[model samples]
Target: MAVIKAEAYGHGMLRVAESLAPRVDALAVSCLDEAAALREAGHHQPILALQGFKDERDLRAASQLDVAVTVHEDSQLRLLAATRLHRPVRVWLKLDTGMGRLGFAPSRAAELVAALTSDPNVTAVPGLMTHLACADAPERPENAAQLARFEAATRHLPGERSLANSAAILALPDAHADWVRPGIMLYGGSPLADQSAAGLGLRPVMTLSTRLIAIHALAPGEAVGYGATWRSERPTRVGVAAIGYADGYPRHAPNGTPVLVRGQRVPLIGRVSMDMITLDLTDLETVQVGDVVTLWGEGLPVDEVAAAARTISYDLLCRVHDRVQVVTG
Candidate 1:
């Protein structure tokens, strides 16, 4: 399943779903609303709501939409066991192997599986699934441990099983049970902290570019941007680019974070403001107003920018606001 939750990690969910419909066997979303949006947009592929329904109303809507749901907790299970829908709803029994977030206890897997398989409202035997907490860190024991627990719990279960996430898809082949959930990888972000996307042979699918609107020649003592956080150490040419936190550029990005100007890397020299950022263009003498500046993507990796900002690539990608115009190629 191609996990395109959170608007495909802010890369535009509907478009991504449209593009992946012919390629993937199924799609996964965080909730019913996302699945409903895809259905309304005319997509007929299978969609799994990862968070499942909150109440009977949501369960009824899921049934109406023919959306599969994750039965992770007792409340959802209770609701599913008691409600009688017009049609059976496909269910995936999520086991809490080690993720600690969602899922029922692994020890109850046998009881739940038996109950779900016999339940009149359930479409078929419930598919067993689990979330891995440390798939990105291959050296961590949690991945193997989770896989072991999952296998021990559902080794003889009838329905299909799903365990691998984006990180596991790249790192743990053993965890790729029956369905592999690819989220960040589908958007071209590296799931491993120690690896780069390019190194992992994953090219960025989105590029965020802005234009340099103004330039300034600053003297040694002149300070730049809000709070005067950065000052010129010598003769400096500062290029002001038209993007900032309001547009989803990290405000916490410190001086020296790289920005691409004319495809050349230059250090961001001051505090990232609400509307713009200042870049040190002292070496790029030919840079001028209206020159293209890449915030992150293509020549500049979002991971690098995210690292300098002390966050993850996921945060940077999802935080991109509506103000930023999206141009798909």
Candidate 2:
């Protein structure tokens, strides 16, 4: 089962999960609130809480809600050990392979599993899990190195193991284990370097779009946007989009970044502002007010947009401005 954590990487969790429910065995989230929200919305699919509980109350709520918790540390284990619940909790043990973010050390996973499984409150002890650091870069040896370490650490463990994330599922064939947790891939983001989800026949679940608020014609030497960083070298037709850094459009996107206006690629002009961006639509013949512009979707590849913003597609997808109304298609 693959989990769609953090609103399916900010692509609207409930809607994304609902669409994926038929294809995925289960869904995973970051907290109790998210799990509860999904349950209330009538999602019967199993939901795994990756962060686990912070206190007894949370643990009790999780037990009542029947959410699976990823046991990442001994402290969380201690809390679980102390708590008396109405029902036993299912747990997926997270192992810290090389990602320094979370999970138990590989050397101590067996001990932790022993402690967790012995507890009567613990229902399921699905053994061993680790996150890949560079599965997207197939040329990088880190993927194999991490997989080797994880396999070596769990070789003696007598239970199921999971190591494949989105990148692993696509790039490293050997990393696939008991269950593959593909997050971004389900939402149509490519974990590979040369291919996109679209190229792989996956549908894009989210399409970020905005309207043209204004249109202006700039002659040679006319400046555009904040910092006046972009000056027209020739007569240019500039269109302003009702999206900016505040709405999660990257501020670092330089001049000449491509934005799709009526399926035409227009070069961005000047600095990205708080609520708008200026695009040079010089060659686009029929752009007007309220023209739909796609910052990154369908007509424009997200990886290309991310490259223009000097960031990664993950950050762009995750940081979409909260103000933008999400429409499920």
The estimated TM-scores of all candidates read: 0.98, 0.94
Q: Please, what's the RMSD in Å of model 1?
A: 0.9
Model 2 ranges off by over 4 Å: none
Local error of candidate 2 at 51, Å? 1.5
The true-versus-predicted C-alpha distance at residue 74 of model 1, in Å, is: 0.6
Candidate 1 lDDT, 187-264, residue by residue in tens: 778999799999999989989999999998999989999999999889999899999999999999999999999999
Best by TM-score: 1
Worst 10 residues of 2 by lDDT: 197-206
Stretches of candidate 1 off by over 4 Å are none
In order, the Cα lDDT scores of the candidates are: 0.92, 0.84
